[model samples]
Target: MNFHRTEVRHRAVARLRAGAKNADVAREFDIPLGTISYWRHMDRAKRGECPGAHDPKCPRCDGRELDSAAYSYLLALYLGDGHIIQYSAHRVPSLMITCDDAWPGLMNACETAMRKVFPDNSVCRVRKTGCHNVKVYSKHLWCMFPQHGEGKKHERSLVLEPWQQQIVDAHPWQFIRGLIHSDGCRITNWTTRRVGGERKRYEYPRYFFTNTSTDIIQLCTDTLDRVGVEWKPARQKSRKAENISVARKASVALMDQHIGPKY
Candidate 1:
């Protein structure tokens, strides 16, 4: 395969930093073993450290303590509309959460969550085709959130680790709120009814969450159940995705008490 020098170097650096053997990296990247050795030497020399002799407590690269609320929010954003990308040219992986350009509040929440997760890293906003994005770069971020992977989320098996599940269990409301804010919406729904002798329209508020991943939908429903908010599942018009609706007056009221509506 034809590969750019920069791309090869980037891959080499990432693998080395992740503690892969030179032979393993060469085999994985399909590069010459000697070339891999040379890259490793150059990388270590640039850092002025011998191979495998780097400090584990390097302030910039060490993992941070997980903030359950912040991480749960970030996780929902990720499962809903966020993706992680690692390019051969970039030193650190990037976590990006894309929101509708019109929803500035949602965008701000995403940025805040990322900053809370990686307090030392800078979060930046970028304008994309029809949405705005909040992004942060950190080498250790992916270790904490290992859900990052290839292919569409629905096509993959989504499961939370034991530690992550514990966080969700302790802060299910925050988790549900994040999921709802990202993939769900609150709207005023109406129905026409006959009262006394005249036909009248009655309006009620409801929440609807739609997503392509069944596992994610199940997670939302399970969390709502745990929080005592009632909901019902429905198939989306496309048939490719599914949704859950919380429309019962009492149920909506309960959700309002817990998740509420994202501003």
Candidate 2:
């Protein structure tokens, strides 16, 4: 069994030790009654000790210190394309981020961030039709990033804690890079013009970020402002969607200097 399965078993045993009925514990946790009975027997044999106590030496159970850069990147990815889901049957939680297969670097970055957060946990990758789902199994992730909630991000209120905001404030460019790599792109815009009675073409590169969450868009724009990158708000056909455009040559140059393009 994996670490997640072991954690679930330990919790079930803990509840059994707390005077909870075997049937009740099994029902609540969706575990087999036989499994609960076995846990109860083991607990009684062990003098009623709680099995949920994590091993201090096990890094997966004990966790590790958060890396500021990896965490900031993970936070931006969560705000952009990452989500957390809890399994009612097993009572296990998992964090997943789906990135386009074409951009394997972003997917690798997601995996790296997850590993940094939980140094001992395995970061699983599942390939879908066109994207790859990078996932990490741990209930602790939900505790770390409480921003994960129900429904679309735009429909809910998003706020960062003082510590998280401090990280963002300290590394705004990295945060912006993660956000842009997930939900934004850099492309060249071309236009035709008539100069001195002659047809001419002009090409310029710009960065565009679009998202459904107003708070996220605001965060992106605010970070850009902090980095001295000027941006303009663009109209979206749907009221739910918001866009930020950095088309000025100077702004694009600045972004290129800091963020460049995600591979």
Candidate 3:
């Protein structure tokens, strides 16, 4: 069997992504037409666009039962620190979430949720200076993440569809966990007190979620309320209502049990 070098194959795929016809790419690269077609097929399969062989069987497209728990969690991650890039008809879109490298477990969980949500698609991680980009390319991402739009997440009007709302209701903790992993954190505040003639340090743990999108913030707080977890507006130095706090002892305990620290 004849084989092309890695660089040649990459150029061929780049041509395909640029809307060049298979035969044209084959002619330009001196590759067999059938081989070019196979390459195209494999690329589409990796993106979950191929049917039967590797299709993701998108719930919205094929009426498959959506993995509600995973979908809810991924949705929170997308809302918090992710973005979807729209592509032309010839190419598939990509979903990317930036995860801190310090929390390798969070990166793994994020990739796991993506795989569960888009079962047949391949997820990849790209490393940055201090973080990793967990990404998946698929034609059906927009169908699943309907909140994807033209601009930044906070700049756009975010609303949940009825079906998505149902999932959030069912797996509120999972959703909260994803959001915390993406844009929230659990921190400890300590103070030294004199007890029995000795200085003792007491630590208080709390959860905080910060987001500029009012709608997303509302969604998080609403889910917190549904689960009987209390939260309040967290005032920052800016004095804006973009921060949320779960500081009550009981609420913090619940968060710790369900979400915990990033790692």
Candidate 4:
């Protein structure tokens, strides 16, 4: 609640410096995990340990420190470019990592979580095709773009790849909610959605992504569901667009209601 509490900030930084887990510190202080990470990152920047601050020409520039605005931009870039951008502009292209044995890690991680949350939900490898070009690798963070409707606020109409979009559509609530819950940061007015010129039906809705500590088991189960792919209505909605609005509204409402600033 108190965003600018210096003592809390200092204590969090100290804990991080002492090699404590960001989540642990966040849980202890009843703050969003992100707030703790932001503070720790800021502290690290002050000490000249940030990744982007690796410029020998200018050992340090305060601008390299990721303030709120920079953080949003970085998030956008990650989602839009799949964390690693290959191209942009009129023909935006990104390199989706690929490998044969890469998926085991992801599958293992997601499977573990699915068992806990939904025991009956099982993950199965449906098929394999070279033409489809299924590639997988491991990374701390991933890119995904969320979707938004007309008259709503979100990011621009950038198209992330199919797999990336599948990840988002399947688990937007989990992705955003997990971040807010895990991070101690409270987003005052953040909108993690994508906007479009017209209301056209895109096969995929959004991008699904994760942080370093994503639950592999849960992720695996969720991914299976995504692969299987179905849509359902929220309990509460109007009659105007019952079928279409349910999925859209439910997705947005969950993100908006529970995925705000937290610690």
The lDDT leader among the candidates is: 3
Residues 70-163 of candidate 1: C-alpha lDDT, one tens digit per residue: 8888888888988888765434678888888877788888888888877767789898888888898776756777777789899998889888
Q: TM-scores, in order shown?
A: 0.78, 0.78, 0.79, 0.22
What value of lDDT does candidate 4 attain over all alpha carbons?
Answer: 0.38
lDDT by residue (40-128, candidate 2, tens digit) is 77556457455553322222245446678888888899899989887554445788899998998888888888888667567899989
- Root-mean-square deviation (CA) per prediction: 7.3, 6.3, 7.0, 21.1
Superior candidate under lDDT, 3 versus 4? 3
lDDT of 4 by residue, 1-263 (tens): 34446677778778889999999999988889877787787678668888765322210222222122222222232332122332212122232322124334433333333233222223233234531122222111122222222321212343445644444454554443332222212222323444575454334222223222223223323533553433342233333322111124444344446343331
Question: Model 1 Cα RMSD, Å?
Answer: 7.3
Best model per TM-score = 3
Find the 10 residues in a row with the least total lDDT in model 1. 54-63
Model 3 misplaced regions, further than 4 Å: 1-54, 191-201, 239-241
**How many collisions between residues are there in candidate 4?**
28
Task: Give Cα-based local distance difference scores for all models.
Answer: 0.82, 0.82, 0.88, 0.38
The regions of model 1 sitting more than 4 angstroms off are 1-63
